[model samples]
Target chain A: MNNAANIAVDIAIILVLIAGISRFRTPAGARFGNAMAALALLFAVAVALYRNPMLSSNATLAAFALAASSLAAWRVSAKINMTRIPSLVAFQNGAGGLAALLVAIVEMSGAGPAPGAVASAAAAVSVSLGAATFSGSMIASLKLSGKIRQTPTVVPGHNIALLFLSAACAAAAALLFAPGDPTSALVSLAFLSLAFGALFSIRIGGADMPVLISFLNAATGMAAAFCGIVIQNRLLIACGAVVASSGFILTMVMCRAMNRSLMNIIVGGKAPARPPASSPATASSPELTAAPPAPVAASQPEQPAADPLSLAADALRAAKKLIVIPGYGMAIAQAQSETVALAGMLEQAGTEVKYAVHPVAGRMPGHMHVLLAEADVDYDKLFEMDDINAEFAETDVALIVGACDVVNPAAKEKEGTPISGMPVLNAGDARSVIVCNFDDKPGYSGVPNPLYERPNAILLFGDAKATLASLIAKLK
Target chain B: MSDLLVMLVVFTASSAIGYVMISKVPQRLHTPLMSMTNAISASTIIAALLLFSSKLDSPHKVLAAAAVALAAFNVIGGFTVTGRMLKMFKKQ
Candidate 1:
């Protein structure tokens, strides 16, 4: 195919991919859109093969690789539970990065003609980025899947180490233009970049995973685009750029949702060092293994004689309007089904129920929606923070399940805190509040929740599943 | 030189268009959209495949084949999982 024809075909395939992404305006359309995207990728692969046919042996190898990987991926994706989607997505992203890494390595060390200065630089960058993304993504997946501590761990001179590694990577990349074969330089560069990625991500954790993952998503896309430049493939370049931009936008959106800057997350992680002194959170529960039976109310002038669960049940049963807020803890407790079951019961009892979803509620952007959808909750009931913030005021009960930070009124009334400027669901405005959290401890941000101390609030602090299970019996 | 310039133009134009279109997608679909884009990023599969169109040693060939496998895995896994997640959404 001539250059113009190749461009035309690439454009056509990209348009098809765009058509697929455009379907994301709704969930039903997104399913079709996902299929369209897959189809477009297949078209690109087929066209490339036709344009440049491989020898027989190479063809056999490619076929085997395709079949084996496709079968493995299909099996895992088809059977995996929805709650684990974030870690799965991270793992897949790392695979893409690994591909880019290998391709860049081959380009750099191939017996083919040496590349020009620009192409060589691009190749070096692609290798480093790809390796970095792979390592960083693996760490993030480990954290998300609970293989590592969810809190940010900062080593001494962590920032300094990151800077030094970045400089070393750049220095090693420059060595790619040296006289001998680029093998040594490539290895050093890839190693430095991998360390850089691991270091960059280790200081980010808890509620910050959304931004970190999204940022890594952008980095991997960028690596692919740079790889395209080295190989002179327009299709790879275009798709890489598209993914890069999409990930970048999501990163920015997540930062804005938390009223934070990207720099703050990557550098100034877990800023407050400790929860505020005014907090009455001394009665904290640390272990999830032991399920506590009673719900401890924070800061009541006189402790109510009745059981907190019964009080919460009474409020829920009498509620004319209810809003349910879900968080990452909900996913940890796997209380999605129980929560949905209770919501259904409330709905059947004539209480209008809605869900208020904070953008940073789950591990990723829109993660809670996926979990709730898996539990058979209607998508229409999910409302974004801005859309449902005001409704909390007029509602009869704000039933919070495994959520914090998002409902903490301290975000509004405090300053100089990690989540000070963050926008929170106004669950505190509701007439009555029932908090079904894992504990009375400060949330992921380590900021004490004043909502737990509200006069009308009832804290059912325990395993969210058991708490909801007992509450589910309230209506029965 | 002109080819490089043209490719740059294509990259910038597509990125701009993707940004605009992706911004239109509601938060409800962010997970599926991101996973779908993850699949699309594996377009390096073309470049990985092209690695074999030229001559190479056995080690290079093995590396190239590994690239092909990883890219294929990314594309297939990302899209399949995204499809499953999207299927779970219901309007009612």
Candidate 2:
């Protein structure tokens, strides 16, 4: 095939792959896919560079190898349950950054003192950025994977140190441009890059892993694309640009979900002040946990579904205040659309409906938010843990949809529990609690919610999506 | 031409399949998926480092050995970390 056709085909393939990969919430298996993509692109580039048509055979072979690996990975992943996938993901991201850095190093060392000033300078920038991302990602991965501490590890004057390193890298770049030895300049830049990466990782806390990972991913891609520009490879340029742009957007979305700024993650400081406890008396209260078992489960139809529905219908028909509490079960059932529809029904009935998002609602952070966003829920209706906590009491009807842990009063009132320190939604504090859960199974933390046993709490047992859709149908 | 086409077809198909496999995965699997990916990544790094360092020829054997060392680090460290993650699910 001709170079132009190959370039076009390669670019198209890479763009599709990037789009497909980005569809993942946390992008599981992205690194494996990325590595394969890199290898394929590398082969194509080497063939073009050597101008050897026969190298096409090698490219085919490499492609086959990548395919085989991906399939094997898929099959193995399907079998054994692996819990450390995030840590592994972090590791692969670090490795990708490392790969980019090494590629830059190889290019710089081999090119020597190229007479083309513009090309050389661009290459140096790519190398420096690549090196920084490589080391920084490694540290971030370690931090996330619990190989290192999640607390602040930044020394005094850490920002000052970063500023100094940036200055040195700039100075080194200038020296290289002034007909100085490229080797020395490259080496100096490498050191600066390493130092910069360390400081950057130290500044970030564990809470911001998702944001940091995405940001570092973008940095790595930019570096690779810059290297591509240096080497004049159109395919590399296209692929790298795609990865970098998507990574940045993902980072932004993750930060926004936490109601945090990207700058806060970078500079790193204290999180929001936690609310002080009221008193031990409130914490030790037994009224919250002593209600009958029928309220907690499908133990009995305590006044039947028709009665609660009539009450909910009355609340839907009469009130202006309605809050929907979504949980992991909602995510598991993929019930965001149904929940949205239910909320829409309530809103149409003149009830102001809002989603009360509990911090650590689902399996990972922002799990419910991501699902809701996928189902086209309005971004404004989703409230954070603190923002929506106070309003729960004023809510005329708290529609607890497929939630267990976050709404559990046990987290707040019961001392010496597993998740006692973890703040949960005050759904029980509302005028009435209507719970839609699957069964009597405890939550991920392996504890039963006393809020489930409340006399005011109505239990509806069924599939989350089906139940919500049914409820929405009834409301309509 | 056939070779290039073969590569493209294979990779696309594999990724599609991987997407399916990844879709059904529970949160319990997140840590394991991460560990496996890390293992593969570390392997790639070692391979690349070895290939580059070997090109230098000076202490080429040492470079190859170092590459193997990195691979070992990835495997052992990867598994250890993975085990710890799995331990979270043991009882609680």
Candidate 3:
């Protein structure tokens, strides 16, 4: 009967995972996926209760723990804003890591002097990876939440320090299976892993955060798998494997999007410094003061700045087909609604409008999609970079709404530049380009965008939300 | 097969399956993908609960209980958030 229950639980989990995967292809699959997940969790809890002898004896305490934790988690989920979902993910990943670390601590403390080699080794890995994930994810959360500075904090010789710490962790793990007292060695391993996690994550810049977060999520999953191996749990191993592989795939996708190797990210380089703030002529625009100062080498020679609102309005009036490109700037200015409004007006005027989204456009993966989704933008009109790149040449006007780096022409023009090989939207290929950005400050890569200076491109300098509003008014 | 070998097979096979399964997901669902995986990982709560309910002493029991709490937090928080995020993506 117990064996049957265990098998049932395993089958339920596998079904849940299958349902989750099916969500991508089927419109109704998400709802089904959540229901299956809940059922799986219930079955798992039941099996856990049945198999553990102590649960019957200490039922109250165990029930209390489960109830309290679930309530707290539910409250957190209820309160978190959609915009801060990434930070919430980071926190949950950290909590998972902490759970694994606690399991390792429990096992280590209970192990006799002559614990088996397998158990010791598993425990060691569990502790090390768990501690690393826990601390690293906490730092990632802080960076995402604006609690810590968002830029990469590269300490001199960070790689060497990480290498040294890794060596220490390995040595401590080896000591766990050796003859002497393993307790002190385990403690040292945990400390080193925690320190390594902090040091490793602090050096990663904002541009690489998606990769780092995915990588850490994978690491935490593997650590949980190791904890399963130590405790001889089949369910954990299965779930952990799924999470690890999924996270690994996401990490690779993010890396490919950035056109950077995982090795390059691990080696820890600094993002180029942002240029000094550029003061815009329009003092009424509050976002100008908030925009990063333009570097001294302002690429665009101030062509008696044209009235961008009128220029954009005229272009829209004449345009037959328009493509909208949005990036981190749109998210920063909270302009998705305004962007959608502008698109609506353009559509009403008989101009065909479409949105082109770069893979790594915003602060996180799929950020622009979510923001636009919130504004009720039709999903059919949204196009990925590859799908939309070919249409740029025929596009009458490519309206870049606060997007800079992704539309920069320098990626194709120059060699030895930061974003040389990165796949960017072909916004520059359009007959006319209008950049609705606060200033000419370079993007996270800190490379000057030559697209702004192109003859076909006109800069609409102001806050994206306000500028789009004005553009809409002018169009009317 | 030894217990370890059986586990190794499960781990390897699940990982391969997971890679294929996750790869099919569209880029737009990446955030929900992450949170759902997190929810699955909370299966470790079973191990924690079993440990806590064992005949261990006070300190070990406390640690095991803490593990249960943390894992429970991941499970509940992860699923709830994933559901909320997915609701936003429903056809409107």
Top candidate on lDDT is 1
Candidate 1 Cα misplacement greater than 4 A, ranges: A275-305
Candidate with the larger TM-score of 2 and 3: 3
Record all residue pairs in model 1 with backbone atoms less than 3 Å apart, i.e. clashing. Answer: none
Score residue A141 of candidate 2 by CA lDDT: 60
Candidate that beats the other on DockQ, 2 or 3, i.e. the better one: 3
Q: Which has the better lDDT: candidate 1, or candidate 3? A: 1
> Which of the two candidates, 1 or 2, achieves a greater DockQ against the reference?
1
Error of 3 at A339 (Å): 1.8
Q: What is the TM-score of candidate 3? A: 0.90
Q: Write the per-residue lDDT of candidate 2 for residues A1-476, one digit (tens) a residue.
A: 34576757655655544443333323334334434443454444454444423233233433443445345434433343222344444555554555555555554555234536655766676768767876887787677556788555768888888889899888877776666457677778878888898788766754456667667756765665565555454444444555465455556655654446788768754343222332442353334322233353343355444444445555566657888888767755667778888778777767888888764455334446545654556656777777889998788878887777677788777766545656678898887777777654555444567876667675665677876776666766
The C-alpha RMSD of each candidate to the native structure, in angstroms, is 3.2, 12.8, 4.5
Going through the candidates in order, the fraction of native interface contacts each one reproduces equals 0.86, 0.02, 0.62
Better-scoring candidate (TM-score), 1 or 2: 1
Cα RMSD (Å) between model 2 and the true structure?
12.8
Query: Residues A1-476, candidate 1, lDDT per residue (tens digit)?
Result: 33687878989999998899888998989999889988998898888888888877677887888789889988988999888989988999999998999999998899988788878888887999899999989989999999999788899999899999989998999899988899889989988988988888888888899999899889888998999999888888888999999999999999999999999888897677655642444433433212221243323335555567767887898999999999999999999999999999999989999999999999999999999999999999999999999897799999899899989899999988788989999999999898899878878888888887666687788899999999998779
List DockQ, one per candidate, in order: 0.86, 0.05, 0.66
Tally clashing residue pairs in candidate 3. 6
TM-score of 2: 0.52
Name the lDDT value of residue A69 in candidate 3.
Answer: 96
Off by over 4 Å in 2: A1-6, A15-82, A111-115, A272-476, B1-92
User: How does each model score on TM-score?
Assistant: 0.95, 0.52, 0.90
